[model samples]
Target chain A: MAGVRIALWDLPTRIVHWSLVVLIPFSWWSAENHDLERHRWSGYAILGLLVFRLIWGFVGSSTSRFASFLRGPRAVLAYARGSGDKRLGHNPMGGWSVVAMLALLVAQVGLGLFASDDDGLETGPLNHLVSYATAETLTELHELLFNVLAALIALHVATVLFYLFVRRDNLIAPMLGGSKQLDAEPAARPTMARPLRALAVAAVAFAIMAWISKGAPLAW
Target chain B: MRTRLIIGSVAAGLASVAMAQVPSVAEQVKARQAGMKSVGAAFKGLRDEMSGTPDAAAVKRHAAVLAGHSSKVGGWFGASAASAPGVTTAALPAIWTRNADFRKAASAFDVEARKTLALANAGDMAGVGGQLRALGGTCKGCHDDFKAKDD
Candidate 1:
């Protein structure tokens, strides 16, 4: 069957995904170099991205929505059995991996908000909210969670490679270009969520992040 | 026969003396960790206070505590506990492998801490902040090569 290029991932979804791809490793590098200033900025960016993704999950385009991808056990089983649809968006098994990645990222950023370096010099923006001992514990948890996130990310890349090679699917290409080759035009062209709405959501996310970075003063 | 017995007795006596000098490994590890925690706590206190309205008296107190801990750091780290059985520490083997450099780092921290105390006493808050960063850099220098990484 001849496949036609059709719209798939919307602009916001593609932007968010690509931004995270860059930010995650950059966060790791900053931490490794003891560049707390850079690390903190990266953390703020990640938090903003996560916030946007969470909101977008509810209201973004069809392929980007949780309701569209998250499926029941039967669906997952069917997917495992190689009987599920593979034309576009997240496959059933892949949906859970997406959720897990998002959940781990949330935990990582949340812990980072209260973490401090061993010397007590480099601290999270909201480190003031917790006691010193509590901050230390959060720092430890933050370290531990990064390990988990790194492991999941390795798994994610390996899975994508598996699809690329074994399954003969080019998952990476669509994420970059925002369209998939479908045998027929999608029954309904994906509802590309409005750019104005994405901008509004992004503004809210960055505002909240900036406020927190300032220790979230009570005066305002 | 008498000479042989006398030499054996002397060696046995000296062996006991040497054994006595070797401190309890467990206690050393615990005490070393306690020193680091106290330093960390004091440093954290000073940092937190600086973030807002700093109490001069408290700044002096925290700086004094930091100085006290820094002075004792070289001793705590002098003896390697990396190979102690049934005990665990984040101190990497390099702390001992590069022993001279490790001691130098510990000395640098001590110098910085004493200077920090002097600044606090002078009520030079800005100077104190800059010194804190210098002090932290000593920590980073040591941590970079000597300490195990978190991630």
Candidate 2:
């Protein structure tokens, strides 16, 4: 039997994910309640988390790379057929969902940086770049996307539950504990410490995200 | 729209005469001060009537004052938008390029302002708050797209 010996999540990656789970809802609540200061700061934190994840996915570990989980359409289709095939880490569908979620989040957070609440007391950091008409459209899009993300999240949770009950799989446990013991080889293991090279990459990505969230300075 | 523009221009001209040279920042400060004053007086009027029986005349007075001042507020910005470049203001390069969107937002504010006036005239305090909330939304809508954050 394949024992769960590898570490799937590094310290930084785990920290980023849990922080985001808390921050996203907090930011949304602040926005709705017209808590400008808290909303802006929460948004900054989200941007930081996203940036860190993007970097970590690249060079942190073997399983974290896009190449490992991002499969061809044919492979994805085969996996969907209940072929009893499994991935040690992210399966193809889950991988694509991750990409979609990241893209949507980036757009949402980016537009919010420039949003104004009309009361002179609140505005996004980059609101100065666009025309009022453009801002209106962006704001509307951002609001609509929130609903879309919520629906997607529900779907994702339902799928996980389906896997647990019907497929007899425990996907959530792996994510929580960063380990999965399977009776198979070629499975993903977690990383305890990210290499210095990976750390440097993560720092660069964080700087880029911070710069973008701050309205790229020159554009400001 | 044209009439409001004229009134705004006239008021702006008169306001400018009081100073040697009214900087854009100074003009903005003056406009904000006036807005605060008008809102304060209206809120006080609202509070005073809470203890009394429903008064139609008082309602009309409140509606008229709000509509007038709101229009002037719109005009103040409209005039400023028109005359901004003359005063060396780096308001945002996109503001001039995408003037149509700015105008649309301004027009939208005027439309909502009129709607609020109609509701107030009809003595529908029950509905005025909702309408005002929607009106406030449009203001943010425009600002998000066109205006830069306060420097």
Which candidate leads in DockQ?
1
- Tens-digit per-residue lDDT, A94-141, candidate 2: 878877777788888878876655453355766656654566567677
Tens-digit lDDT string for candidate 2 (B1-151): 9999999998998887855344465577466556735643443343234323436566557556656665554445544444433454324545557777766776676677677668778888755555655666665666677656532
Instruction: Report the lDDT tens digits of candidate 1 across residue range B1-151.
Output: 9998999999999998987676666767788888888888888778877777788899999999999888887778666354677877778888888889899998999999999999999998878877778888887777778777766
The lDDT of model 1 is 0.86
After superposition, which runs of candidate 2 have C-alpha atoms over 4 Å from their true positions?
A1-4, A184-198, B1-151
Give the Å shift of residue B146 in candidate 1.
Answer: 4.4
Writing each residue's lDDT as its tens digit, candidate 1 over A107-169 gives: 999999999987777888888788878998999999888989999999999999999999898
Model 1 DockQ reads: 0.47
Alpha carbon lDDT at B104, candidate 2: 75
